[model samples]
Target chain A: MTVNGVEQVRDIEPRLLLVHLLRDELRLTGTHWGCDTSNCGACTVWMDGLPVKSCTVLAVMADGRSVRTVEDLEGPFGLDQVQQSFMDCHGLQCGFCTPGMLMTARKLLDDNPDPTDTEIREAISGQICRCTGYRNIVAAIRHAADAEAAGRGDT
Target chain B: MQVPAFFEYQRATSVAHVVTLLERFGPEARIVAGGHSLIPMMKLRLAQPELLVDVNDLHELAGITVEDGVLRIGALTRHAELLASPLAGEHFPILHDAERVIADPVVRNRGTIGGSVCQADPSEDLSGVFTALRAVAVVRGVDGDRTVPMREFFHGPYETAVRPAEILVELRVPLQPGAGSAYVKVDRRVGDWAVAAAGAVVSLGPGGVVEQVGIGLTAVGDADFTAVEAEDLLRGRVADEYTFAAAGEAAATHCRPVADQRGPVDYKRHLAGELTVRALRDATARAHRGGSTE
Candidate 1:
């Protein structure tokens, strides 16, 4: 499986979930595993550029697919604009749901960079965050949009 | 941690290979496409298959097209794809409305329309929607292909007419000209299973009278989950408040719902009537002219 821009081939069981493949074998712990069921979006990752719960997906399904996890969002220079916006808007409180939020949020910005507050909520409706309410997450997504728009202006 | 029982996973490249694999493995083998439904069932120990034929790589069966005045949807079409397809939205708003709330977008990315239809759960939204539209399921076996009407497709909860060694390949919905359809589900929250849902397709004739109609309810048990008696009354009658009310009462009387967590028998029955009326009204209005997409 090619994950986070690296191709790591290994023999694994068919029942092995993509979440375990990343956390155990690849040691890419940035993607947290929560709610073994597909209910919680904490295990979300970009499969073929779309957000899908890794816990529900088998590792073999990702054999030839390019998977982009939250780890890939970090640039060599610093945090990506969406990741930075989360910190700036204080999108995290308990931090358990941050990785999934970040990954889903990045995809939202990629598809609809200037999503409205309602659109952001609808996009992350699958995710559950107990500590920090969704108000800040919506703000964080908006912050990323503003930053991206400002970046485009500078160029 | 939840994990499926030990099983051999074989990937099938084409529908023919899948048929061959089904014959090879017998009834103990099951096809795994999106794995959204089967995997969870496996983890919960509800379903244990000796072998799984992974059909995710079968690109041929993954298609959605409308031709010959019929919307032909390949069994492998993903929920996200169905929801995003403008052609589907233009033709059947019921599908789009139900898809939006079937599950979260993350799950929709992998869940197939075939998986939802084949699940055959009584509370499943698509079943009611398809039933109202009078859609048909195409089942392919080693012999040949057979079409089963939606009314006869579902045998019982979690059971369909698709026999062993036969796979549901496609769903065909005959296009309704000068007609509009709508689905209304009243769930406790979005993405949750329906507490009680209703869908209706109405076509008006001269003098704003309902020429044809199909009504279906979910979570509230009725014969075939359809308000056939109600549709009978509504057809050839002016689709006004009085007729709609009468039809709703007929629907409420026909369904036999059971008490559960979402609501009691009485409440669900009430929703069956209420939603039926609401769906009928919206569908009739849209048949005249498009209204709010939602």
Candidate 2:
């Protein structure tokens, strides 16, 4: 599979999970694994173009697909606007759920550049953030949307 | 920490190939699509298949289309797809209503309709919705293809009529013009399983008389997931609050619910009846609005 625009090949057990493959094998520790069940979205990653809980997905299911993890958020210039917004808006307290939140937020902005607050909440509803009570997380997403719109001269 | 037991995996490129692989591996082998349910079961040791056949590559089994007054939903259709399908929502609002609460958005992206229905969990929302729609399941085996009514699809909890050697490829729901349908559920959380849910499809004849009605209950343990007695009572009767309440009472009295972590027996039974009435009310309103559920 092409992970973060880089093709990777390895022989892995059929029962291995995609999150473990990314963390243990590829050493992409940016994606946190939480609540091995599909409930918590700390292990959220993009398969093809949609976000999915990595724990519930088998490694083999991603054999020929493209996976985008949180580690790929940075560009040649600097941190992506979503990451910047999270920091500016205090989106994380313990930072355990930050990766998953950032990944979901980035996708939401990509899909609907100017999403409403309700849409932002719905996009990240699958993920859990015990710290910050999700108020700042929602604010961070809204900030990112506003920043992106301003950069594009739409504000 | 949760990992499935060691098993051999094979990716089937075609539907015919999947059938061949199932036959080759025998009863202990399992076909996985989406793997949202089966993998969790495997990790918990509830299911331990020796061989896992991956059917994610079978593009033939991934689509939603309407043909000849029937809505054909490929078994591989994802819950997200169903929710986003305007055609499906226009034809059956019950489907859209059920899909909204099936699970969170991320999980919905990977969960397939076939997997959810095939899992046959008693609390599954789609099962009850399909039962209310009276849909048909198309099962393919080594010999040929056979269709099974949704009413007879479930033998029990986690047990389906699809034999070990066969694979469910598609679901077909015969379109009912001028009919309105809705699903009502009450879960503890946003994406939790329904404590007790109801799905209703209602059509009215001349003079505001009920022409047809189907009621399906979930989690409350209605045998076959249907309220046949309520349906029988509603047909040919005037669609009103009193009749709806009577149908709800019949459904609640007939269904058998057991106490579990979600609720007590009496509470679940009450939800069954109350949700039935609410669903029927919406369905009746939609029918009166010319079957346009906007």
Candidate 3:
């Protein structure tokens, strides 16, 4: 499997989850491993361009697939637009759910550049933020959309 | 962190390879699609298959097509794909209705309709929706293929009529002319497991009379996840409040629902009736509008 555009191959147990493989083996700690159950979006990542809860997906299932985690949010230029928006809008409080929220938000904005509030909420419904800070998280996503639009204007 | 128990894993390259593996592993082996349902259950130590066969790579078993007025959905077709399919939404609105609330979008990205049906969870909404739609299950085995009606496909909770070596490969829903369908579910929270859900398909005849009606209920029935008596009462009757209310009463009287954290028996029964009534009303109105919700 390729992690953030880097091919990673390892002999792992069939029972290992993608979250554990990414955090424990590959040391990509940006992808938080919270709530082993699929209820929390904390382990959310892009599996072939679609958001999937890594806690429920077996590492073996990711074979020959591309997995983009929150660690990929930054480029050579620094933080991605979505990450910058989160910082600008204070989308994080406890910061436990930030990684998953960022990943999911990036995908959401990529799919729908101008998603309504309802669409944004629906997109992140799988994730659980213990801090219950959904208001700013949603604002952060909107901010990202605005930034992208502004960036397009500049170009 | 929760993880599956020790098991041998094999990624099947083709349908023949899967059938051969099923033949070799027998019932102890489990065919994993998206693993949203099975993986969670496995981590809880509730279901531990000795061998796991991953069919995620079989792109052949993942598509949606409508031919000859029959909608064919592949087994590996993800819930997200089904929700986005214009073909599915056009022919069967009930599928879109259920898929929209099956789970959050992330989970839907991985959950497969085949796994939902094959799991045969009584609380599963798609089972009832499919049952109401009178869909057919295409099961492929070592010998050949066989089609089973969706209603008869489920034997009991967590059980199906799928043979040991047979895998459900596709679902065929016959598109009914002049038929409009709708599904309504009341879960505790957004995208949670449904407390009670109902699917209704109604076809209006000349003079706005009820030509035919189908009712499928979830989280209420014991083995058969449908309200046949309710459907019988609505079909051929006038599409009015009186007949709709009577149909609701029939559904509430027939199903055996138990009280749990979701709701009590009486409450679920009441929802079964009320949702049935609402679904019937919407379905009839949609049918009158020619089954297009654009």
Candidate 4:
């Protein structure tokens, strides 16, 4: 089975979570593992075209499904608009949670191109970013949403 | 956070195939609709089933329709769909309100109404709302199909009257015109489980008198409790301040809440009364008038 564009196959217990598989076996360190529990949303990723906590999903359950990480956020030069917004607005200070933040933000913008502040807050409320106090994170998302709505950048 | 070691898998193609597989697997098997609830429980090792019959792909259990003044919601219908549905949004606005505040968008996107009802979590918003609306759970078995009222379907905490071999195929709710409803829940966070919730449905007459009332309370007892006393107090009375206050007090008396991580039992009971009053007030206002602040 392939994960994040890499092809590999191995037999193991059904209990192995997709998070451990991505981190331990595949060595795709881009997908960071924050609280192993599903409460914290730092382990979020795109599974079969929906944003879900990878830590909560089993590797066998995600079989034959495409999984996307923050590594998929690059466009032409450096970072996607969402990530760039996060960097510009300083959405993260610790940087341990940037990947999950970017993926969740990407899905939110994809679903609602121009979401209100309340909508954006509700969308990312599942994720917990301890640094930057979430004010800048909300600002970054708003900037990206505006940029996307105005056709200014590749949001 | 690992899923249990056991579990054979079968991706069902249709409802018939799912029913056959369920019958074949018997008690050791469980159907996975949205998997939002079952999968999380499997990871916690609280439930270890030998077989998982995946009905996520069954097209039969995946639509909402209205016929004969009854709203028929398929079992596999996601909460996000319910939140976005125009029929549900317009007719059963309380269901829409309930779906809007249930968990975050991600959970709502995957969690299904059928899954929530079948899981029968007393703290769940849908269970209380459905029970208040008098929704019927349509079950399918080898013999035939049977309808179970939502009030009787949930026997206790984390328990349902559904049999191991029976599959919940659809939910039947009345689409009454003058009946206005609202689902109000108070939780620590916007998406967390409800500490105490209330779903109130009221039908008002031309003179602004209450014709009928249904109040269902969540997270207040072992199962979703219908405010029978409050309903009795509200029937045939004007939805004025005095009547509403009396009904609210009656409901507050009936709610039996327990203290846990959320708050103290006394606080929960207070919230039950506050939410009941607010939900009844909002539902009555909507029944009398058709404008929403949203």
lDDT of 3 by residue, A19-114 (tens): 999999999999999998888899999999999999999999999999999989899999999999999999999999999999899999888998
Q: Write the per-residue lDDT of candidate 1 for residues B1-294, one digit (tens) a residue.
A: 888888888888888888988998898898888888889998898988888888888878778889999998889999999999888888888888788888888889899989888887789888898899999999999998999999888888888998879889999999898788899999997688999999999988989999889998988976477889899999899989899889999999999998989999999989999999999988888888732254
lDDT (CA) for every model shown?
0.88, 0.93, 0.91, 0.82
Q: What TM-score does model 1 achieve against the real structure?
A: 0.97
How far does residue B40 in candidate 2 sit from its true spot (Å)?
0.6
Candidate 1 C-alpha lDDT tens digits along A1-155? 68988888989998889999999989999999999999889999998888999999988878888899998998998999988988999989888888999998998889897889988998998898978568998899999998998888933
Off by over 4 Å in 1: B290-294
DockQ of candidate 3 relative to the true structure:
0.91
* Per-residue error (Å), model 3, residue A151: 1.0
- Candidate 2: true interface contacts recovered: 0.89
lDDT string, candidate 2, B1-294, tens digits: 888999999999888988898898899999999898999999999999999999988889999999999999999999999999999999999999999998899999999999999999999999899999999999999999999999999998989999999999999999999999999999998899999999999999998899998898999886588999999999999999999999999999998999999999999999999999999999999999877786
Report how closely model 2 matches the true complex, as a DockQ value.
0.90
For candidate 1, what is the DockQ-based docking class? Answer: medium
List residue ranges in candidate 4 displaced over 4 A.
Answer: A1-13, A149-155, B290-294
lDDT of 3 by residue, B119-238 (tens): 998899999999899899999999999999998999999999898788899999989987989999999998898899999988898888888788999999648788999988877788
Question: Candidate 1: TM of chain A?
Answer: 0.96
Q: Return the number of clashes found in candidate 2.
A: 0
* Candidates 1 onward: DockQ, in order: 0.78, 0.90, 0.91, 0.48
Task: Identify the runs in model 3 with alpha carbons over 4 angstroms from their true place.
Answer: none
Where model 2 places Cα greater than 4 Å from the true spot, the runs are none
Better of 1 and 3 by DockQ: 3
TM-score of chain B of each: 0.97, 0.99, 0.98, 0.96
